[model samples]
Target: MPILMLIEYFRATMQQWSFQKRNVAAEAKRTLTPWAETIIQANKNACNNWMVYPISNSRFVVKSFTHKSVVVDFQQRTCTCSRWQIDGLPCGHVIKVLTMSRYKDCSEFDFKAYFIETLRKNYEESVNPLPSPLESKIPGDLMIVKPPMMEMRQPGRPRNIDRILSQGERPIWQECSTCGKFRQTRSDCTSRGSRSGISQATVHIQR
Candidate 1:
């Protein structure tokens, strides 16, 4: 009976894998058409000057006018909107800046700069490692008492860690707008906040 069950499980797993592969292939074929220009136009239509805020020491915040609920960080190069992170392209507000400035071919639009290598290299030469300058020697006359090790207690509550952030994960770096420093994400920026903020431009999309 056990042998029969094992054989049936194997057959079922193979069928599921085959079905999944076919579905993925079909989806790929459907999405292969050129759609960048269409998406650019759509973004232009919905573009608005969102409020930019410094979310943290290194992050900026932006709020949506139409939706009235989204926050964005220009430093982190992230928006509360789901589309930008998923697509690896600038969001509508970002595209608005590109179009307005007439800088479609600028460095800001280069998607590769957002990755680990180029960003790290931008600041690499500035960071130098040095050993501690102070030297200290243990005093021979000082007596130190060793405490007994207590029984190991089970950890209480687990720390709330962002699962997506792991030690093994490399940073996606971006160039700092203020200091010209390259950093791992915009959050590593060293520039102080500016009182002058970017204005929102109104864009109309064509049908």
Candidate 2:
């Protein structure tokens, strides 16, 4: 079967497994006892490093120990540091604002795009297993693709793909063959008085 067709065939299977992994993780993060302890520690650390001044139920200003100020808005789900909008997780400043809010109706999401119920509902559609590749058959009208032609084998030991060159190093000829010096090739070698190598290859080398 074609590579693309293979991917499409297992697309549902892939999504099903991926959802399972994320679901497990989200549940773990939400319920982890150690994480709660960590949060309590983080809150204490936050107090030492930052000062939050409430502007409204949903807005606040957080000032760091270094005097760097960032705005936090719970209503818009945004922070000046951009973690809330970009990472889809509340930033430290926004978390502080939430802790101070007194309104019972000033609600916030469990998380920005990854609530437990949302993940379950999104992957709720019934997914059936695809037939084994050996058991599957291609349509007769579908054009059968031939194997790709083998590349011509290069002579000499293959260059190690993992080899990293140092600064100013490359695979190409770095020294002039005639004079065995750097920064100049045989085509423009001015120190040819010392040696007469690369005479044959000079014709092939560009001027």
Candidate 3:
């Protein structure tokens, strides 16, 4: 019953957007986070600033204005910084090497996993509407089961009475019981005297 309601809700929502352009890739590209776009743009700009020196057919060394260098291998799709290998996106150094190699579509160095087409295909499947419960034939012997009992939680901060911490799981710092300052116990606390004493000292200093 809940699944049927969810399907119906999804169908109704999809109907509202059915008239809009249905390009999944375009939609996915539009939804890229600002930080992601910034990184891509920064990489592009960095590619322009870096100088590419060819080492072999597929290998090169990219050097920045500051003499900071990184080795780039187009064949392995890797950079010395490891960013390209880990993220599957070409780093600025790799981009500069690709540009020097005369590759027109340096952006293609980015993994297809980040492509809009891949994203679109993931969400392309449509949920079908389920038949009305009244029209469906259920067995006469099968009884309608009641929902499981759920205790209403009391409105307050829950206690961790059931929590069992291991011997290894100790707090990062010991705190004083008297002053509540961390990294020391109550015995080590210097401010154990009355607050009035500290207040009087402050007033005296001010005067």
Tens digits of per-residue lDDT, candidate 3, 1-207, equal 698888788877875454232453445554333344567678878668778788898888888987578888878778889998887777788767767767766557777666556565555655445678899998889988899999999999965533555666643465568777765555545686533222211111110
- Per-candidate TM equals 0.28, 0.50, 0.50
The alpha-carbon RMSD values of the candidates against the true structure, listed in the order shown, are 33.2, 11.0, 15.8
Q: Could you give candidate 1's per-residue lDDT for residues 78-168 as a string of tens digits? A: 6677566776666775565455546554235425544334433443332223333245465799988899889887789644333355555
lDDT of each: 0.51, 0.60, 0.66
**Candidate 2 wrong stretches, greater than 4 Å:** 1-49, 56-58, 103-112, 133-135, 148-154, 157-207
Q: Rank the models by lDDT, top first.
A: 3, 2, 1
Greater TM-score among 1 and 3 belongs to: 3
For model 3, give the 10-residue run with minimal summed lDDT: 198-207
Model 3: residue 23 alpha-carbon error in angstroms: 2.7
Residue 8 error for model 3, in Å?
Answer: 4.3
In angstroms, what RMSD does candidate 1 have relative to the true structure? 33.2
Report the CA-based lDDT of candidate 2 relative to the real structure. Answer: 0.60
Alpha carbon lDDT at 51, candidate 3: 82
